[model samples]
Target: MEDINRFGPELALLIAAGLIVVGDVTLPMRGGTRRVASVALGLAGLAVSALWSLVLIVADERGNAFDGLMVVDDFSLFFNFLFVGIAAVIILASVDLLEKSRFRAEYVALVLTSTVGMMLMASTVDLIAIFAALELQAISFYVLVAFLKDGRSSEAALKYLLLGAVSTALTLYGMAYLFGLSGSTNLNDIAAFVAGADSGTRPALVLAAVFLAAGLGFKMAVVPFQMWVPDVYQGAPTPVTAYLSVASKAAGFAVVMRVFVVALGHGLISSDWSNMFAAIAAISMTLGNVAALAQSDIKRMLGYSSIAQAGTFLIGLAAVAANDPQLLLGTSSVVFFLGTYAFTNLGAFIAIIAISNKIGSDQIGDYAGVARRSPWLAAGLTACLLSLTGIPPLAGFWGKFWVFNAAVRADLVWLALIGVLNSVISAYYYVGVVLKMYTQEPANDEAFQPSPYLGLAMTAAVVGLVAVGLYPAPLLDASESAAAVLG
Candidate 1:
């Protein structure tokens, strides 16, 4: 009973997904009616999961559950709120898009199902549990990527699945090495063994670290592993792209922190991985920003920009692995950055969905005179883009500030410098869109408003970002508390 109680949030979402499927089959509904019903059910389920997580936190109910396969703790709960919120927003954002499809219930159910996996990814402390949770998430994403059923969508999904399979194999091989070395699958047990492992075995540990980082890099959408990002982001439905940008990336970082910091940080091999992450951070930042500058499509541009953002996230991770006073700050900064980024990226995508649904094009040049077509949407997008650019008095600025501060504090001054330069480079493209929107003439002068659902979502995201920007202390404290659990 206690275990079940601790498992309430995930169980709630899983049950809701099943209910959505069963309800769709049993209910006498069709078309828009069915879509509305499905969206409502999906949102309801997410709300319940979020509320239950809050209840647990308030009740101070934190501990290992499912025989320690999963843990109900501050770290997992932080991600639980984030994942559930992203899923709910995606559902609301998809209401208009899903109306065109007959598989509304299936789509919503898959999203909920995938979210459950993400929650578990953050919750699990065992390597086997991590793999299982990741596969559950990846499978749902595979289907969702192809949900559009068009040629491009199919191609994107195929690339994702093929590349994902290779990454999975690499991840499993790495895990096998760890289990072989430690004779255990649990991260705590692995950490204990790693702390006492002989110096001669350092090469084997390095190999395992490389494989794990390379495999998980795909999920984080960082360089070298980011080949699928542009195509997948452009081909997948816009809502799915938004979910991938924020929730998927957050889950990847969460697990990476758990695996690297918790399981490996206590050993001499920590420096090896830290140096690797630092080098990757610089390369990903440079590559992602430079590539984004050449993109014409909005979705593709965001895809590459997401890579750059992921690199910035690595700044914190790199710092966290070091034995320094900034360790807690490093991990906490990443958590806070992820939180702020969720609202920032979701707002940008939601605004794009609103504009593109009417403009019928994803090209940057097509956004000319958008401020005239829809001033509010233009304003919302501008704020988000500026936030992405790391401008002050916005959520994005503080996220960058904290991570770079952590990097500098950890004595990774070179990585922090690279991050600053990349942020400057990113401003060019982000502001270019804003310039086109306000200064150029519209191709056509027919004004329109976003749908109420989209308007609501965009508003919520904008508000969340701005609110956090104005007063970030609560979130900072929460992130610090969450990161402390790792040690």
Candidate 2:
């Protein structure tokens, strides 16, 4: 019972997956099966997440479970909750899309399984565990991205799989090198080994770090490594695109924070890897913003925006590696930024999906006269886009402010400047969408009726974003406390 309690959340998700499969096989019914399965899985996920939150509040902060493969520290607990929250939102927002597209029971099961993988990735402290969790998540996403069974979805899945395989291979090769050097797959052990390594061996350690960084960068959609993002986002189903944009990115960053801050803290600060991250930070920010300015497809533009956000996040990593005394603050800033990004991005995507469903297109021009057809959707989209543009009194503004402030405090003044400039550049394109929505005239005289479920979901996201933006003290405090555990 105690063992079960320890792994309850994961077990719950696993059971949810099982129930989905069993229900699909046994019931073999149509019409409402998809809805039933999706709701069941969503409820199970929410229950597990609630339990995990309760555990975080009641249980002691523990580390090193499963023979040191996992760690239930504050960092993991925080991110576990974040992923679960994102999953719940995705599930809720997807109901209308699934019904319209006639998705099967497998869709729910795969989403649950992928979420479980993400939770595991957040909690694991060993290299092997990270690899396993990553692959599990990747496989699920590969299928999810291609679930539409259309030519475009198929092409996206192929690109995702091929690139994802290469990234995994690179990550594994880097892990092997690290194992060879440190003689252990445990992060703690590797850190200890690197801490006492001779000068000659340090260069090889940096090389291994570079390789690992590259692999994780691919997942985060950082520049140069972000080649697959635009295609994948454009071709994948809208819900899958939202999942990839938020939950998957959060999982990647979770692993990055654990591996670097908790596992390799000492080694990274004392080695050349810090400079590498700094360089990557500079280049990624410049490239992502520049590319985003040229996009007309809404999803493709968001793909570039995602890459730019990743670059901003890299500044946090650079600060951590530099041993900036404000590491906790910096980490908290990143987490808060992610929360804000998720809400705004999801809200924007929700509106996009609603509009696309009505018009059957995702081009920027399709958003023209959105205000005339659906004022509520236009308002939601405007709020989201304004937030994403970092407008004051909105969620995105606070997120970027905190991150840039943290960067400045860490003495990365130039990085902060670059981040500010990028934010300004991003505003242009973000507002462009709003302009098209409000200024241009509608081509047809038809009223747009968004699905009630989707409208509710978008309202929730928008309200959450505004609430968080206006009152961020509570969330910031929680993030700070969670980040303190890494120390």
Candidate 3:
């Protein structure tokens, strides 16, 4: 019963995915009819899984399942709720995108399955389980990215797959080194070994850290590993890009928080590795923003912008000073950032979906007079854009505030300064679209109405953003609790 309870939420999603596939095969679904049915089935399954996850979290029945391979704790529960919500939002937003897909049922099923993998990534405490979960998520996304037969879609998927393979190999090699050094697969045992080991193994340990960071950086879209981001974001379906931006990045950070804090957080290792990530943070922000300024494609621009946002997120991890054994502020700041970013970025992508559905162009110049085309969408997107720019009284501002505060606490004031300057630089390009929408004449003056479902999703995201900005207490409280559990 304990094991079943610990695994209930994941089990629900797994069963739901199977049911979706079954419905697609069993029901009389054809073309557009099939797509609608898939959406309905996908939503039903996601709802059941989300409700199960909620019930499990409320029960507060934390434990290590599968002989300690998977731990059900406050930290995992927080990510569980986050993953479920992200999956639900992506499904809702993808309904419009599905109309253009060839295999709608498969697309929905892959998304749910990948989300399951992300949940497992959060839950598992074993290195083997972590690798398996990551591969599961990665494989699903590789297929999803290439779902459409557009010319660039194949190139994007191919590049993603090939590069992802190299990163996976690097991660696995690092895991092998760690396993050999520690002689244990469980993180607790590994941590105990690493913390107690002598100085002779420092080189091996540093190599392991570098390899792991490299692999995870690719998933998080950090600099140097981020060459594939712009092409993938621009070529793939917009909804998939949204999912990759938020959920994929969130999962990468989850694994990063888990591995670094749990297995290699000894004072000697923590201080050195923290500085390494801080350097990456500084570079990712500077390069992502500068590159974003040159892009004319809105999707590509946001893609580079995602890389910049990731840099700020790395600041959270980098701020986890070796002296802070409590693991409170820095990790919690990351949790808070991911939560707000999920809402704010998804809100922006939802707007792009609604707008592009009518305008059928991804160019920034094409967005001239978008406010006149659909006032609601333009307003919602403007709000999201301003939030991303870290304007006051919005969700994105608080995300930046907490992370920067963490940097100060960790004595990384210079990193915090760089972050602030980057935010200002980002503002110029981010608001350019807003200016285009409000000031420039429409390419074609056709006022298109948004679909009710997409509008609802955007409205929900925007509301969540504003509500969080107004009352950051709920998210902050949850983030702090989650961070406490990791240590």
| Maximum-TM-score candidate | 1
Give the per-residue lDDT of model 1 (tens digit) for 76-195. 999999999999889989988887888999999999999999999999999999999999999999999999999999888999999998998999999999999899999999999999
TM-score of each: 0.99, 0.96, 0.98
Q: 1-487, model 2: which lDDT tens digit per residue?
A: 4445555677778788787777777775777765766676666766776686568558773656677787777777777777777777777777875775655567877888898898888888799999999999999999999989999999999999999999989888888888999999998888788777877886677777778888988888886799999999999999899999988998888887877776567753343655667677778878877898999899999988888888887887777766547778777887888888889899988888888989888899888898999999999989998998788898888888888888788788988898888888988898888999899998885887778778877988899889988998887887787778765
Please, what is the whole-model Cα lDDT of each candidate in the order they appear? Answer: 0.94, 0.82, 0.90
Model 3 global lDDT (CA atoms, 0 to 1): 0.90
Clashing pairs in 2: none
Q: Which ranking of candidates, highest TM-score first?
A: 1, 3, 2
Identify the runs in model 3 with alpha carbons over 4 angstroms from their true place: 30-33
Against the true structure, whose lDDT is highest?
1
TM-score: the better of candidates 2 and 3: 3
